[model samples]
Target: MVVDVVKRCFRVFKKANESTGKILGNMIKVQELRRLWGICHMDWVTGLPPGSDKSYNACLVIVDRFSKTQIFFPCCKDDTAMDTAPLIWNRVVSWTGIFTNLISERDPTFN
Candidate 1:
């Protein structure tokens, strides 16, 4: 019996780029966009294998509308409102200083 020593990489997901035209279509006034960019949008990502407790991890998405820049944060699953609240506040404040608004979607775990 002959064994092959080569290892193959797996394609776990599909990839596609958002077109420039699509980005241009979403544009707003530059100044207002700058103000909006100061705010952050956060959401928790869940849903994984039933037996995999590690799926409890949270994801924080920060978007700057003006620059169209985005940053992501991966946090622990066991984090609570008290814990997460401060963490999110500190992170955004540090990056953008005083932001006028913050947007967050309801996460099932926090309930």
Candidate 2:
């Protein structure tokens, strides 16, 4: 019957697709978490025109890896390490004290 032929063809197609879909490579190794506030990740988000504060066009987001606590700091688009250093000092370092590791994506602002 036509239905039987269609089902057979569909099974063959599915088997072929499944074989082609598998990845033949090693997987990425994940880093081990050691302690609270040990690793802090930082990143900047931009593209907002400006807020009511007028001075800030972006935000700096910091996350503690172990605790998963986050802090958001309002920042200008042009702010560099010189500007962000004090903000990190006042907002994060003051509260968490010194941490062992800091992780961030390659961003010019963090440099």
Candidate 3:
């Protein structure tokens, strides 16, 4: 019963997918990322209770794409892009050195 339902739904979806491709014509291809030390990814972990001594409720996580190494910096929830950029530059980059590319989740404030 489930298999039959799935096949029916898949047929409908496949027809729509084919028609959309015909209407859209060409599709875009994204360049693949190479395993290179030049690439790095960053993200924020938020919505946590304050820590022991300081009132840190969030963390800025930076990961090296090649090395798979991570550096986590504890931060307050109120830190803005201005504060983060400098902190990453002065502290994180100073230690880990610089990278060619930085991939982020495009967080509203992080932009």
Give a tens-digit lDDT track for model 3, residues 1-111: 999999999999998877444354465443455654467888889998899977899998888777788889999878899988998899776776676787787787765
Instruction: Please give the distance, in angstroms, between residue 16's alpha carbon in candidate 3 and its true position after superposition.
Output: 12
Pairwise lDDT winner, candidates 1 and 3: 3
Better of 1 and 2 by TM-score: 2
Q: Which candidate is the best by TM-score?
A: 2
Whole-model lDDT, candidate 1? 0.58
Full-model lDDT for every candidate: 0.58, 0.84, 0.80
Off by over 4 Å in 1: 1-36, 48-56, 109-111
Candidate 3 off by > 4 Å = 1-37
User: Best candidate per lDDT, number?
Assistant: 2
What's model 1's lDDT at 107?
Answer: 69
For residue 100, model 2's alpha carbon misses the true position, in angstroms, by: 0.9
Error of 2 at 86 (Å): 0.9
Ranking the candidates on TM-score from highest down gives 2, 3, 1
TM-scores vs. true structure, each candidate: 0.49, 0.68, 0.66
lDDT of 2 by residue, 13-56 (tens): 99887865657687545367888777888888998789896888
